[model samples]
Target: MPAPDLSVSATSAVRVAATVLWTGPDAPREIDAPIVAAVPDPRGWAAGLDVPARRDLADRVLTQLLAGEPVVVLEERGDWLRVVAPWQPSDLDPRGYPGWVPRAHVAQAAVPARTEAVVTVEAVRLEPDPGSRGDGLPSELTYATILPVLAETGTRVRVALPGGGSGWIDARACVVRPTGDGKHVEAGAVFTEARRFVGLPYLWGGMSAFGLDCSGLVHIAFRALGRIVPRDAHDQAEAAGRVPVGEARPGDLYFFARPEKSIHHVGFAAGPGSDGVLLHAPRTGEQVREEQMNADRRATLVDLAGRLAD
Candidate 1:
């Protein structure tokens, strides 16, 4: 699927899924998580997804290419996605951005044909909204979107999306440009650099645990170190591109949800291990601390959470 021409500004972070969702006919449904990426359905059933959802809908769609249910997907503008699922009505416009994508079980697609296997992975693209404070990157940039890159042999290493799907790239004809400082997300640097704020108080809407919200900690900690991230749980949920939580290194951002996986809160990925531990500013009058990532503990609230960022 080819993407439509849409305008984007520098400083925005844009993330693409390996697979995409198209607009559905008209079935109204909602998935879990704070930030949602969805496409509209002409009939009305849109494919919805959230990080907090059971299947991690966004991942399922992009990585697997198919949302578990029977649905159609459209490649929206560059870095944008859409959905078309059952229960949607035909009166809708599948071409427009109906907003949030829904949650769903997705099916994985087989590897691409040998002809399309030619490719290269570059630095992740973080697209923020237009006029973002990203310093020099696009405001709507997410992780990497197989943009057109030229290979030394004169062949184009066309980029696909984290959304799944490949295209051809010309080695010489296509020009691949470098964008953003990439400082906020140092590839080799684990989030360990952000652990300095531990013991700060947990405040509502607070940035440094001196009263911080889940996403607040992420924003403040990274920003303090010259790294920029999104505000709010939803925004952060779409931030820093995608990395398996299990594979997360220190300094990585960790999103948490109530038992519902609603993306209600977020935390810093302190270290790795099944201990499921994360660092955050505990709530009001509390201090920042490294708490267990116990699924049950996170539900009813655990280890006195805190706010971490701006």
Candidate 2:
């Protein structure tokens, strides 16, 4: 079947648990078919690949989009869609982070009018109401996924999916709030949220609890608290206020780069008095971890840290 002719500027919602945004349509390998499919299984995709294969994904995978997230359609190729995700800010495009994702992973739908709920756990099951027709909804939703709340009952909340139909999740698994609610979140709270993914594996361009890249870790952590930061390290550094390393505070961002080079990595400062403890998703083969700022890391550490306004 042909994909619908979604005009430029049309808004669509991601309908999969985590859709891999590829560098281009030809970037995905045969083994990556599952992840690029309409009903994606991220865990299955990851589990099937070994360390080397997983690391190789960096060459093609640009980023990831969680279920129900909004994207503005820019163009459509044979089986891929070029879209801008305004929620994930990046200097690459003024509109938002620019990327290509499988067209099947997103759909045009009416933006629901209701309070939004953000998934707060690693993953939560979405169950259909008794005898309700399934709409190919994902069985699990990853953290930071936002959807409109349609109805609520004790211990369960029904959410309207972007592709249509509603699914129920544990009421306790999400936090309901008005869309675009702006509130000051303490740096300590942001640090606390980031610490939750201490041991998650590093995936290039990843942005969910399933996996995360350096900037993605910072992005999602801040997002979980209703704060939206840039989706990449350089943009984040460019946008945040600079703070002297000696005065870095907990939850402050630590950007790393070689002399005269672009910012390539980011992490949270674990500071009581700027002792230089850092928590970050290090590299493709490593897991997110915390370590004291060693000499090697200091060599590339930016002199000034980044602090987002409260």
135-210, model 2: which lDDT tens digit per residue? 6778899998888788888788888776666789999999988766677778899899999999888888888887
Q: Give the Å error, residue 158, model 2.
A: 0.8
Backbone clash pairs in model 2 (N, Cα, C under 3 Å; residues 3+ apart or in different chains), count? 0
Candidate 1 global CA lDDT score: 0.36
Tens digits of per-residue lDDT for model 1 on 102-189? Answer: 3322222222222222111212223322333232222111111223221234443434222232334334332343322223335224
How high is the lDDT of residue 121 in model 1?
20
Model 2 regions lying over 4 Å from their true place: 1-10, 129-132
- Which ten contiguous residues of candidate 2 have the minimum total lDDT? 1-10
Residue 306, candidate 2: how far off, in angstroms? 0.4
lDDT of each: 0.36, 0.82
Highest-lDDT candidate: 2
